[model samples]
Target: MYSEEQKMYFSKNLLDWYQTHKRDLPWRRSKNPYYIWISEVMLQQTRVDTVIPYFHRFIDQFPTVEALATAPEENVLKAWEGLGYYSRARNLQSAVREVHERYDGVVPASKEDISALKGVGPYTSGAILSIAYNKPEPAVDGNVMRVLSRYFLIEEDIMKPSTRTIMEKLARELILDGTASDFNQALMELGAMVCTPRSPHCLTCPVMAHCSAREAGMEEALPIKKKAKPPRPELRAVALIEGTGEHAGKWLIRQRPQEGLLARMWELPHVEWATTAWQSDEDNQEALRAALAEQEQIGIQPEDWFMDTEHIFSHIVWKMKVYRAKLGDANRPSTGEEWIPFHYRWVGPEDLQNYAFPNVFVRIMREWQEGNEA
Candidate 1:
């Protein structure tokens, strides 16, 4: 436990440092709760540099709660195509729609009311209330946790919920009379810019003089976070099915089922294989053909292996082998047209922007385009 005077010195010095040293972030320019809400959601599991342009584009497109609420979900997904963790966009829209209808487009000021919104967790609610409404709620995220764990020399695992509760209590106490907005942001800035995860810049930290971890020479290792389980690997075979004749210069793409992982995003036709049963490329091609034909009524003659790529999710890693192919003769109708399922579309390069595709598929298409240009 830190002395009250020590906490006061830390808070005052940190706030003073932040007043002049904080980055000129767009979200900080206004106290608009809606904008703060969007920025908070986008910043989750994302870097500040990456979120900047996305924030500008998103705000320009859906400038208000009503705009985001009424806009088609496809447009939202398309705007969020490359950002990944797309469920954030979906949940944000859902919650915004609720705010538009229930709160007349105004973000809720009370913690309970804001917390009730979908995707608005304790941190988000705290951010919205404090930053936008000047309420003294502690917005404790991973960055804040790192700062607190070091400044106070806390050695508990931050991954545990009980540890988080303690941190939250300490953080709430640190908030001065009316400095919640800048105080929380200061803690975050200190953690990000000075007290980094590795080789913390202790020489430049505003609160380094009294930081308990610095005093003990354990600044870099105080925040004890347990490692998460590694993602399980799964083998997948992807078919880059090219069109023929009048449909030349196009590739077949399909929409994912309306639910589950990467829900409703577009991707190249692919089939999964058990890791233990994985076989050679030729056998994999045969499996891909049989699987597509039996499952989706699509037939293809794989010409050769094109590339190998991998996408890692929280729990799974898809190690994909891509093969170039042409539609099999059976799928060709006598009218010189191809009969694809309704869910599938033959998209040319020009039509790619009209649909939302997962980042992996976007990478594949970009590679194919670059290869053609080369």
Candidate 2:
């Protein structure tokens, strides 16, 4: 338990340090709740450097709440291409639409009103309320938890939900009147820069003088978190079907099913194998051919092998082997049989603008483009 004097010193010193050393982030420049919300969502489990370009482009494209609400979902997805975690984009748009319609394009400032939004959770609600509205709310995230645990020497497992509640209350107590915005951001900044996960530069940390973990020489081990289960790897075989005849300059692609993982995104045709350690390339290719023919009614004759790659999600990993192929079935829309009926399309490089893809697909396409250029 931290004393009143210690908490006050932590809050005052942190805010003062932040005022002098805070990074000049674009979202920090304005008090717009919408921009702040978008940035915070994008920042989760993502790096600051990676979010910078995406943030700039997203704000420029949408510009306002109404702009985002009115824009087509496809357009929004295209803008978010390669920024994995497609659900974030979908839920954000859904929530933004609510704000536009229900709140009259104004972000609700009250905790009850903002917290009720579609994707706004405790952390997000607190962040938006404090940073955007300057409310005395605490925005406790992984970074905040780490800093708090070290400063107060809290050894509770942060992975547990109850631990978050305790941290939130402690964080709220540390905020000075009218300084919640700077104070929260300061705590976040300190964790990111100095009180880092590994080899934390405690000497440069703003609240180091009163940091309990530092006093006990346990700064590196204060915030204890349980290890997560390893990702389950799935073996996948992909058909890099190239178009021929009038469709010579294009390649075959398919849109994923609408309600599952990586939903509503464009990707190459592939089939998941039953096991990670499959028999052989020949067996895998034959299985892919049979699966596509039976499942999609699309025929293909896989020829040579292409490059191999892998993509990782939170709980699953895809280890993929790409193969070159040409469409053997003339079931395409242009070839007679009805294709409205078809979820696949032959797309050229120029047509990539019309669709969004996961980062793995983007990497595959980039590699293909480079190969062609070379």
Candidate 3:
């Protein structure tokens, strides 16, 4: 643990360094709690560079908590499209609504109140209170953990509860002259720029002389973490089923069930691939016909379809095959399915701009559109 004097010394040195070297990030320019909250939430498990554009776009779309609260969920999701982990978008909406309704459109000032908001955990709460409100609280994230472990030569696995307890105590002890806001930002900056995860620039670190891990030649090894679990494997067979003329301009799009991976998102019609043998083109067509009948319950003759692509995802590889067919007199929406009629002004490629599409669909659309343009 860091002594009171040592903490003060470290904070002062780090803060001085930060004032000179801190990155000119947009979030750092303002002390608004709402802005800080959005940046914190977006930065979770995402790179700083990646979060920059998203932050600007989100803030422009919803300048205030009330704006975010009133915005449709679909618009919010659309704005957050490329950024994965859709739950964050949903939780952000919930948090905005709560802030508007309960807090009179003001972000909560107290740590407890901020922490009570949806998806606002201890780290986020700490960041808001310290950076926005100037409260003397520690925002102990992975960056801070690395800096602390190396500074104090801590050996416990960072994943362990005991390590967190010790690190939090040390952070509190080291806050400089109650400049919690600057001190917190300074430490975070150091971790990001100097005391990085791999090959940290120790020679340039402000507190290198005091870092025990550096002195002991174990700077790279401190803050040990537990091994990660193996990724789950899954297989899916997606169909790029197309419709007949003017209808041919659009394709069938379906909303996924409101639970599990990619919940409440739109996707192409797909099914699990069953092991089967096809000896010829006739056999392949027959297999496609039977699978579509069983899954989509659209009984169709094999003669009316053309096959076309395949796509894949991490942990879930897809063997996608496209089939083009015109909506014959027999082809219509069965129970539980919606047919975007051809005459209803097809959702033109440009109109798709406002909808939140999964990355896979986005890629497919890009390739398809490019092909047509070419």
Which numbered prediction scores highest in lDDT against the true structure? 1
Clashes of each: 0, 1, 1
Lowest summed lDDT over 10 consecutive residues: which window, candidate 1?
272-281
Point out where model 2 deviates above 4 Å.
Answer: 330-341
Alpha-carbon lDDT, every model: 0.91, 0.89, 0.76
Residue by residue across 1-374, what tens digits does model 2's lDDT show? 56999998898889888888899999999999999999998998899999999999999999999999999999999998777888999999999999999999998999999899888899999999999999999999999999999999999999999999999999999988898888889989999988899999987878889999999999988799999999999999999888778778678899999899988889999999877586677877889999988888888888878889999999999999998888875455665652422678888889998988887876777787789889
Model 1 TM-score, all chains together: 0.98
TM-score: the better of candidates 2 and 3: 2
Model 3 C-alpha lDDT per residue in residues 1-374, reported as the tens digit of each score:
35666566688899889989999999999999999999998998889999999999999999999999999888998898878778888998899899999999999988778888999887888898999988888899999999998988888899988888888878877776568899888888898999999999999999988888999999988778896554444344444455555555565566666778777777655555565332354555566666766756554444432333444434454555444333333455556354443322234467677667777776665666676679
C-alpha TM-score for every candidate: 0.98, 0.97, 0.85
Q: Report the alpha-carbon TM-score of model 3 versus the true structure.
A: 0.85
Candidate 1: residue 251 Cα off by (Å): 0.9
Positional deviation of residue 267's Cα in model 2 after best superposition, in angstroms: 0.6
Return the lDDT, model 1, position 296. Answer: 95
